[model samples]
Target: MLTCAFLLIVQQAGNASANTRNGRFIVTITNNDQPAHASLPGPDTLAPPREATFAEGRLAAAQTGAHSYVSPADSAVRQQIEELGSANTRKRVAEQDPPQSIVDTCRNDPRADGGKGHVFHRLWWCQEHGFTARATDTNGNLLGEASVNYVAIAWGSYTSRDILVELQKTTLGKPTGVFSDPDAVRFIIGANCADTGTGNGCAVHYPTVNKTLTEWGNDQEWHNWLITSDESKSTSPDLVLRHRWNLSASVEVPGGTGGPFPSPTPYHLIRCDSATYFAGRPKACINDEVLPYITYEINSAPAISVHDVAVHIREAQDTPDLTFPPSPTPKRIPGKYIYENPKDNGLRRIPEADEGPNRAVVRQACDQLRPIPSDEQCDEYPFASTMEGAASPDWDFSAKAVNGRENTRAGGYLRWYVFWDRMLYRDMDSYYVNIID
Candidate 1:
């Protein structure tokens, strides 16, 4: 349609790839309905208005000869083929290239809707993961609030690793890509960008969303966490490396309740390497072991706050039947046995740091609770649930069935946030445990 630099909206909707739609990609193409230059009026300017008559020829050719079906923009914007006398047209077409949409399709043919008449698609075995993500924007509201619809296909994938890959790729694009702006280096893809294909977060992420951000609502429940990153920013520091959230899609109809969000599910930082695994051991061969923060949420409720506890408080208190002492025991616990490291061995106690923060926290715990089995009530807080390689370490973990959660305002739990990485004593992550009150 010709106009005075007219404005028109073209939405690339539909799946047109011969490749599987779910084949690691949601390819979108702008336009797909166009006739081949060969099918056009041969070298005739005075042919039909446009190639609108391409269907019949397309169908006929598909049934017989080999038809070259380029991109929608490319199909119409190509240099006229060396037909009877279309050299001039071909030159003009070549000089003008194709439309911006055509150019975009060449680079990234956006995935289409469930129909046809769109750009061709392919599975890009990208070394990178996080890219431009999209989502639905229709928050069904009546008169007071207006709504816009953002149609995006939701995809399930990694958050940090993918974003990291994209960052690395972006780095390659820059003069060095190793700029000093840490956030820029990390959240380059930006936040909330992961609306479409999500696992924890979008394009870019930050750990502050977990650490620094003010914990909202009450305690003893899951908390709705939100973080954003722009391709213009970095997500490394702000993002809990490997952490991810399971997302569900919801559409606010023109007349529906919007904010009583369902409970937030548990999300653990996905090992950047966890993507690849051996059947024998689920945990990949991680030399520098670092586990992501697990969502300490009960049910699907949003948690009120996040706390760090000793690794002992992560899961329910289970005993490792390895007979220690005169019976039989190992000095160190295996992380794997503690449900931590597969090669994890035995874990004892920090032996009290004598002073400083370690001693302080212990002392504080002892004072807070009056009775704890005895004086070492908080002392012998079952440093380790000790459930490695045995039917069960005949110990009652009933009272100790503490999942590191504390009943406060919304929901709170004790988790460990190790300063660095440790493969052996996987106890570094969260040392915060909730007392069964």
Candidate 2:
């Protein structure tokens, strides 16, 4: 039974290699809401735009005479408003308009909404997350309000390891609440890197010129903000937003250092906060709202290799359990095989036959299922080319007996994969393997 299974497994493995579609990557977006509305004042404030009640409140407030006011001729606008109750003159305060929508549909592709365009469908890999603050008086009447939408957009290049990134902020529209001075309420945006290896760095490059919220909001251009990474050291570039939200009106970068490990790929974690205050009374500001964590990989590498390469181990044909000892462990779970070299300072190069620590483990596992026929080889689930191979300290793996010729062909396919997909060194890259029929 075992000999017949090995023959079938090797033949199917060969067929799989011939029709392989190697390099494909999937991105995941997570909404972090741990830091939102921590400091905003009042109980009857407008909900954040990302919430359902926010739109309802906007329509309700608009009907309640929450109209935009123009600064009157008098310099003491506050005093004039105080003298003429809010119901009378309608306090004159300046609120900024929402950031203009991007013109480049190529970058900011319109997502198909319930068959209609929705506000949340602006960025391809980004979800709008931010703060909504409303300043109210002792009587709880709405004074001033502002909504800040922080969007971190990143796209990895298919040809290189570099990533293209930009920061997007929008009020969504004019504020329903009014404020005193236009500049009294301020917001600054910035970024910081986290978990990058020592000596490795990530930085955001953009113009130094200061612009008003209107100017910043109106400029929806691409490649305007660039995020560059240092290749000297390898790490999983994570972005963490600290409490100091006093950055300039432009979007920003993040950094801390560490060795590389298993992760999706290069990505950004965007967050927003408005705990800042200007010289104003009846003030309110949101503490923070960590936006969606955007992660993606450019799997395509041109003629040298197939893009987004993934390994597929067919269960019925691969016969994972048909070893000499007849073990029943399932070994082809998708994405379990991570190509890495943790024993070698986080490098990603596959180790040679005698170089890796896994050789001992592979020998031991194969020895346990000994008395093998000369025509078959000890086949491992992670292929001895990944971090979780037979020699892994975790000892969380399986090995099977497969035909020598078929296993050799599969090895050839993996060798070609490394060249075709431009698999980078370190956990900076990753690929998934699926167990199919």
Candidate 3:
């Protein structure tokens, strides 16, 4: 029975690999809101001109018992009123006119009632930075909303160079082979925030949006991870890293503010590393150790009212049970696998001395099987060894006020680290790391 089951698993794995043509996959992220469909205004849709007779009739009603009803000055005032009303009508129509499109398909999406409503725009072939979008109402009010959907297609046999080129073209907008259908390629949604909210699900402040992306690209730790070809090479066989942004204006708080707050520009980056693997085995050997690291900078001090700022590393808690051991079990093999490294094992922390202005640089390496010590000290190292069985150790990072303050209101840079071991063959196919506040 065991042999039969193993063969079935191998067959399924082969089928999955055959389905992948060139090893290319598409990734899409959206705001979870539906795309805004509104109508464009044209020259013929202006409000009709108001009649002079109707205006004069209303004025006569107000002067029925007044003594100045038939004065010469009243006739002159009526004439001026009619002229001003006509001019005002024309001015409003002019203000409502739509701007010329920079590209052929870039135009306002017409509304159902044949009135100006919303704008639906597309951004393809980005020059620098990733694809982004923004929308506004007829009055030029930012909707602070976005939704995206996209898929990946394989054009040829998968190669690291080819995969990287496509990723840069789709994300940072590097020019590549001309795509026939720009509209079908990709989309972006961007908007400005008018104010901050005290509740969850509010608009994301504009400053936070700029700060997060800027720091992500500038931080040295992030740069090393992104540029280091060998570190993540096993997990990213095609050398393609997938990222999706979930831009939100909401946050969790005590007592639940009726709505979302815009202050923290809450966002998440979903990263996926794609490396090919066979049924229950990796195509090539990899280092048994996995190291995921994050680096951040506090650009300025927190508000005076703020008390303590902290960084937290959380890992999944589960016991490891072995069903099938290695081909040949060791004579002294233990009953169960040790899921976590010792508290003092392979831990490193380097925190810069505090300056008078509340600025410091701190780095911590926390693995899935181990937690940062209660006193937050890293002073030990242990011999590294590969695990005897497959395990998944997922971890995340969050920086905020531990006490006195409710949430972080100030701006700072933060990144998270996640590591995987070679014993788990799946890491060669894909790996994930997350950042949060």
The prediction achieving the highest lDDT against the true structure is 2
Please give, for residues 1-437, the per-residue lDDT of candidate 2 as tens digits: 00000000001111112221321111111112222222321122211213122223223222332211211122353243232221110111111211233323322543311111112210112223343334333343444444344443333222222333344553433543332233333334443233223233445555433333455456553223433444333322221111111111221101101101111111222221111111121111111111111111123223222112212233312444543334355433222221221112211335454336666666777888778789777776554676655555543445666656556655665553343223322242333342211
- TM-score (C-alpha, index-matched) for candidate 1: 0.19
Model 3: number of clashes?
A: 22
Q: Select the stronger candidate by TM-score from 1 and 2.
A: 2
Which model scores highest in TM-score? 2
Candidate 3 lDDT over 1-437, as tens digits, reads 00000000001111122222322111112221222212211112211122112122222222221111111123353343223222322232244321122112222211101111111110011011222332222333332222111111111111111111011111222212211123322221222211112111113212222222222233222000011112243233433332211222221111212212221111111112233432221221121112221221122234322122212211111111121111233222111111221121122211222121111111222232235445333211110111211110221112221332312321111110111121122222212112122
Which stretches of candidate 3 lie above 4 Å from their native place? 1-132, 137-149, 153-437
lDDT of 2 at 95: 15
Tens-digit lDDT track of model 1 for 88-175: 2223223433223433432343322211112121101111111111111123111111111111111112221231211111111111
Better of 2 and 3 by lDDT: 2
Q: What global local distance difference test value does model 1 have?
A: 0.22
Q: Report, for all candidates in order, the number of backbone clashes.
A: 97, 19, 22
Model 3 TM-score, all chains together: 0.16
Assess every candidate by TM-score.
0.19, 0.39, 0.16
Summing lDDT over every window of 10 consecutive residues in candidate 3, give the lowest-scoring window. Answer: 1-10
Which segments of model 1 are wrong by more than 4 Å? 1-323, 326-334, 337-417, 421-437
lDDT of 2 at 159: 25
